[model samples]
Target: MLISVIIPCYNSEKTIAEVVSLVIEEIGKMKGYESEIILVNDFSSDNTFDVIRDLCDKYSSVKGIDLTRNFGQHNVLMTALHYTKGDIIVGMDDDLQTHPSQIPILVRKLNEGYDLVYGKYPKKKQSFFRNLGSKFNDFTVRKLLKKPKGLVASSFWAARKLVRDEVIKCKNYNVHLQGLFLRTTKRICNVDIEHRERKVGKSGYTLRKLLRLWASCINFSIVPLRLSMLVGFIFASLGIISSLIIVIRKLVFNNIYLGWSSIMAALFLFFGVVLMVLGLIGEYIGRIFLCINNQPQFVIREMINVEEE
Candidate 1:
């Protein structure tokens, strides 16, 4: 059996070489499995692509691709899927946080008739804000994608070529891998794995990026639109009831004053709700336009070690 391991590198020059070497060594120890390592440099502003080229020269099983720009992690992974030649594909980060030794566990779970398996880390080693973003992401996945209850989706995952093909067939510009995986199949499982501290630069996550990730989830799922409808209905009903109460008070009791403060408060509250709903709808429409315009998922600048014998 052939296994293709894909690592998405971004500003990971410090640890890319070591991480690739460790992954190769670990894959070598697994019996009856030939391995190919694909390193995708997502336009890193460092020597990450240079180190990957050297690794490709030293290791016949190593393959490398250089993207034109930073297309985000999921976009890079989706791009690498088309170049994989293994019967099974594995996805992981360039940092050593997801140890290569844990790969066998993910593969073992896949062997048990699962289409996909995620390596779960009970105690993550990320920063506080990063953890918070992850938690929010998990919550969003549960609500929007209807992911299995208590399933902690990590970056490290293994899947058969079937799932990989299905995931790559998704042609949307806004892609959420977990959402795609969940939409693809329910025959998924998870195994606990160790999470190590970063040995190089910090994570690429920022407040803006995390919010964008959440927005991607919204783009793929109609839950947000549905929730907006619910909110709109509730607010509309409340406004009607409030207006009725005001009218009844004015008719039953004389000299009732609905002052300017109350009027301005009502106006502000209603307009805020309206604007929020409009923004949500506009996001969906905007993504649709981008997709219709055929936005490229990623542009390849260079490729190396792809023709290994």
Candidate 2:
């Protein structure tokens, strides 16, 4: 059996070499089959690609993929999947935190009759807001995808090549791995894996980045748009009831409709609700517009590839 380990790296100059070395020493010697590492550089502005080149030079089995530009992590991984040649493939963060030590365990689980096996970090180290955002995102994903509650998802995993093909076929400018995880198949499992702190540059994911990710993710799920519809109905009902009261007071109680200000306020409120509902609906429509246009998710300025023997 051949295992293909894919490490997507971007500005991870500090810890990548060590992580690659660790995987080579600890996980590459497992029984039954051999393993090779495929490190993809997502157009980093640092010496990351050079470092990967050096490593590839030192280790003949190591493969290096250089993206023309910075396609988001998921995109980078998705594209890199097409180049992988292994019976079972593993994807992991280039940072040392993902723990290559678990590669053998993950592959072992895959050998025992499982389509996909992912890592579950005992604890996520991030700020309160960051953690909260991730959990909320996960909750939204589970509900939108119609899965059980608290279904955990992670980056590091081992899976058949077919599953990766399905994921790559799914095209979207904003791709969420967690959503694709469920969309790929109903048979997915997670195993406890060791986690460690980043031993290099700070994480690229920030609050603004998280929000962008959320916006992209939510568009794929219809749950939010459904909630928007329910809200529109409630607001419309309230608006109708309010108008009835105004009419009743004007006809029965007189003297109460004595103000142009109230008339203007009612018009504003009515149109405001109408516009809001339209805006909500338009969000979904806009995605349709983009997809119909068939825009490219990323532009490839140049490519770096090494032919396999």
The TM-scores, one per candidate, come to 0.97, 0.87
Which residue runs of candidate 2 sit more than 4 Å off their true CA positions? 249-252, 255-277, 298-305
| Model 2 lDDT per residue over 1-309, tens place | 778888888998777898889888866588777777888888898989889888888887787877777777777777667667778889999888888888888887877887788888778765677678778877766777775564577778989877877877777766776677677777778788887877776788867766666667665578877787788788779888987988988999877646899778878977887787788778778887887887556554433445543
Per-residue lDDT for 148-189 in model 1, tens only? 888888899999999988888889877789888888999998
- For candidate 1, the TM-score is 0.97
Residue 159 miss distance in model 1 (angstroms): 0.5
- With a 3 Å backbone cut-off (N, CA, C), the pairs that clash in candidate 2 are none
What's model 2's TM-score? 0.87
Q: What are the Cα lDDT values of the candidates?
A: 0.89, 0.77
